[model samples]
Target: VSLQELMEPEAGTNRTAVAEFTLLGLVETEEMQSVVFVLFLFAYLVTVGGNLSILAAILVEPKLHTPMCFFLGNVSVLDVGCITVTVPAMLSHLLSHRPTISYGACLTQLFFFHLLAGMDCFLLTAMAYDRFLAICRPLTYSIHMSQTVQRMLVAVSWTCAFTNALTHTIALTTLNFCGPKEVNHFYQLSCSSTQLNELLLFALGFLMVGAPVVLIIASYIHVAAAVLQIRSAEGRKKAFSTCGSHLTVVFLFCGTGIFNYMRLGSEEASEKDKGVGVFNTVINPMLNPLIYSLRNTDVQGALWRILVGRWSLT
Candidate 1:
């Protein structure tokens, strides 16, 4: 049978299987295209430069050789991977008049995009817990969270993220995208589907993403409570300062994430909604390292020391 016949076997039907999709670039105006291209290009370059500098600073500064910097390094790696997954494709589409993505390519992009995003989520939570232990239980922190334990935590975070992405991607792969292959967003992997895939995706979102967020919140709450119990003003200030940057990142990351996913079920989602989703995914990954490094004096000093030839990798 022909492709159309296989898609709609009944006579006089008006459907054919959609084998590919056209991603509606962010906007329709040619002027807007150039503007967005330049803007995002600058952003992408800055993100890459900032994260690479942070990674280099961490590696060169022996003072940064700790579990915290190790975790930060992983976050930087995830940021680069996450931004790379979407920015290149997005930039290409924005610059070109006609933009298209193959079905397989869309799925591949979706897989890595979600993979890095999931890793960021879990890693942020791990970072929070790490800070909590460091601040709230300084004496036993090393004993409880040794180097081996920290490595295990990081490994588990990446493994869980990959598994979550794989589950969503596999579930989406089983979906049949037979028509209307035009995605009305810049960088999403949405597909035509029956109800089963939607339900599975929802379940996976809750289990993999939602559960970790809850745990993260609980951890920070305890951290905050511990900080409050500090009798000395200097101790309270120091503890709060240590966690402030992390808290800012956590809120920005999780707040945008929850907002985006909550709207997935809404039938009335607007183009702006998709725009915000793309903005969060493409922009926030790069911002995480900058926010942390800029806000934390220790990280700033480490970078300075590395730059001034005062630090060595050995």
Candidate 2:
């Protein structure tokens, strides 16, 4: 059925209160769908397992009980949540004859997706702030970023993110999706239906999205200044090394996200935007644990010890 047909249900009947929405799936062809199904499933599992491993290592090992590791554990948990919200649903719909999601479930998905993704942004910013303290203000870092303070910051970020998600959800629900129930992309939203919301989301999203990037940049600028003042070249290298992983993550997470949303504003990027969406939602989550694990000596040592510990036990 053409999109026009879905938009105009028999003129006599009312379709304002849509019961459900049909997704267009990832690719056009059935064969492509099967391939995407395997790919997405593999990505989801790796994302979950890798993040869980990060969490497990932190939990069993006492050395990882510091403020940095604690916040990282929170990021791992959010990464798991971030992927779970979309990938499982996308996977279920990938090969189904009727790729549909009910109204409430769809809205619920939108809510949690934003909630967790927003938390990811804030948490990264918080991590940058933690680094700022640990590096720039080393002596006062312990006093300023105590366990209680760290926990409180994390709790506040969650609360704020939850509230931000709720606001976006409310704005979305304000629009009545009475038109075509078929969502052209993998997710469920008729393009024509969301034009208004898309524009609004971008405008509002500047604060949600732009604020974090700005904050991260500002934090790093201060960090650079602090590093430059270090008398020894080795000292500066060590400081930058501690921050390298986080900066890489921030770029990967925000760079793809910005591209995806920027594409939302144009019709030409319809298909390409889907690819960007997949990158941010699926690929980014999977990469986060890998980035931290590979970049940090602490995570590497912990994982090594963990493997040997289990190996000896068995």
Candidate 3:
């Protein structure tokens, strides 16, 4: 039941808490739900497999052992984590009558969702810096992004993401869910006592999610400035092309994930909004490896040799 109903008809009543929550599925219609379910299933499969492939390529190919590929591997792991936390559970709830999720489970999802989401933000920013250093200041790129330093960057990103998730989870747990235990949208933490909850939610979206987007843009601006100094058109074209895929990913992730988070309280979460959420959480991960990184000359070359070389052995 909703937290409101379980309360003592008095404000600030946290004694009677909601034990479980009913999460919203993407669509209610049988046909639409089925279609979305299959789509999500396919997306999840592709997300996991595609990301794994990228990770594998990075690991197996000695040529991809640079700081760029190293950071990309971390991104792949974060992408997989981001999608896995939502899609599997969502798929199971597609048409089920028992759509109940325990309060603990809900918090678990919230924690990991924000955790990976935040990691995605920082990792992208870190990647942007990696790109900047490589393109803008190539001489110092190796010095700044040594294996030890890159590992530290990944660790710091992990710490920040964990802290963000922890804050959101703790903040959510303090609030009482009154009545109507059914989650109309995926799941949202609501507070009846104070306005602090809203501020906390907004901070997570803005500080953790929005902040990184800004940093990325700023980093790209610097990169662009440095690229313009190069006299050769061919040289400039190559630099921009290298950055194109990353820019595309930054927009896609921040645009949809932040939109869904902001949309939670403003309107009734419709199928379309849920679809956007799914795309952000599920399909985006799949698209990154497929559309962004997989088609790169380096990755493509590695895959070709692996596949074609295997045929020669056969």
Q: What is the TM-score of each candidate against the true structure?
A: 0.88, 0.89, 0.88
Every model: Cα RMSD to truth:
4.9, 3.2, 3.4
What lDDT, from 0 to 1, does candidate 1 have?
0.74
Superposition error at 150 for model 3 (Å): 0.3
lDDT of 1 by residue, 249-268 (tens): 78887778777777764546
lDDT of 2 by residue, 1-314 (tens): 01211233435665545566666666678888888889999999999999998999899878888888888999999999989998888887775656777768877988998899888888898888888888778899999999889989888888978887888788777765554443344333443467667666787678777988898888889999999999999998989988898999899888988886675534343666677778888999999889899878878888889889989999
Segments in model 3 whose C-alpha atoms lie over 4 Å from true places? 1-16, 95-97, 179-183, 186-191, 309-314
lDDT of each: 0.74, 0.79, 0.78
Q: How many backbone clashes does candidate 3 have?
A: 12
Q: Give per-residue lDDT, candidate 1, residue 228.
A: 91
Per-model tally of clashing residue pairs: 0, 0, 12
- In model 1, the clashing pairs are none
lDDT of 1 at 84: 88
State residue 72's C-alpha deviation in candidate 2, in Å: 0.8
